[model samples]
Target: MKDFIKVMKALSDPNRVKVIKMLQQREMCVCEMQEALGIAQPTVSKHLKILEDAGLVQSRKEGLWVNYRLSGGGSPYAASLLGNLKHWIETDPEIIALREYIPGLQRELVRKKQASPAETQKKDSSAAQDAATERRETHD
Candidate 1:
């Protein structure tokens, strides 16, 4: 019963439902989901966490990204819902639009755009150091 309620609660939000719909298509990182759903990264992550806790999704570590896919099933409720979801919402305009938008979401480009200010600054510093090193080598 608790599992049933948790799954229900997890799916209560439209964004979360859209997430399940997106995962049904392919595995995606949070950045990709954010771009597709037009939501914040942290919000997307929160949605993933809820979905994971409800056994609606699973994740794997791939290099720097954690990719999420629809879970095979943890409980009967989750499995039943996952199965039903495949046949549902396939025709809604928003769902159709989302599916089309997803393919265009380049994870690498999204990640680059999502880089923190500190990370960007560090990258800039690294590039400057590389230029200085090149100049010094040329002078020698």
Candidate 2:
């Protein structure tokens, strides 16, 4: 009963549920989840921790990345719940939208983004400024 309550509580959050759903598709790193959910890295970590504690998810080290995936054979309760979840609420519009983006999400891309986030933002800002300047000149 305690394990069940913990698992239920972990699944209570929509973000955590989304994390489980995302992991159903493929193993993901925290950075990949952050990009998919448009949330901060710390938040993703928190959700992962809760899920891990609940035995719904597990992580393993892969190089510099810790990849998270749905647990297969941990607690029977967790495994049963995970199996059911694969078919549950999958038709939700939010889930549909998330599914659309999952195929394009890659661990390497997330790593690259994290590696030079500031540089990427600077480049994006410069590009936007250049485009604005061009528009202004045209209007003038």
Candidate 3:
């Protein structure tokens, strides 16, 4: 019953449950989730760790991004709960809003929005420098 308890604990947090609900639609990275949920990246990562520990979610590395999805293999308790979760509390207004928000989430745009001003400045300057170099090569 330890697995059962773990799954239950993972679902106890509203944010964690929301993460699961979003993953039910498609694979997502932390940045997209952070934007959709309006939560800090560290907090979102913490929730993901707990959900992974419970075997309710799995992750894979794609390039620099780690994407998460509902785990197909886990304790029987996890499978049962994940199956039932599809129909649970989905009618609530918040869940409906979240589902609506997922389609518009883009990781690149979300990360840019979250970047510090200095970081954004550095990127902008770097792009201008690269453009200058490209123009010099083209003229030479």
- lDDT per residue (tens digit) for residues 1-140 in model 1: 99999999998999999999999889998889998989888999999999999999999999988999999888999999999999998998989999999988888898888899999999999999999999999999
| lDDT, model 3, position 53 | 96
Judged by whole-model lDDT over C-alpha atoms, candidate 1 comes out at 0.93
lDDT tens readout by residue for model 3, 100-134: 99998888888889999999999999999999999
In order, candidate lDDTs are: 0.93, 0.90, 0.94
For candidate 2, lDDT tens digit of each residue in 1-140? 88888888998999999999999999998998999999988999999999999999999998887889998836787888899999999899989999999999877877777777788888899999999999999999
Candidate 1 TM-score over all chains jointly: 0.87
- The pairs that clash in candidate 2 are none
Decide which is better by TM-score, 2 or 3: 3
Sort every candidate by lDDT, greatest first.
3, 1, 2
- Give the better candidate number (1 or 2) by lDDT: 1
Question: What residue runs in model 3 are displaced by over 4 Å at the alpha carbon?
Answer: 129-140
Ranking by TM-score: 3, 1, 2
What does the lDDT read for residue 65 in candidate 3? 94
Q: Tell me which of candidates 1 and 3 scores higher on lDDT.
A: 3
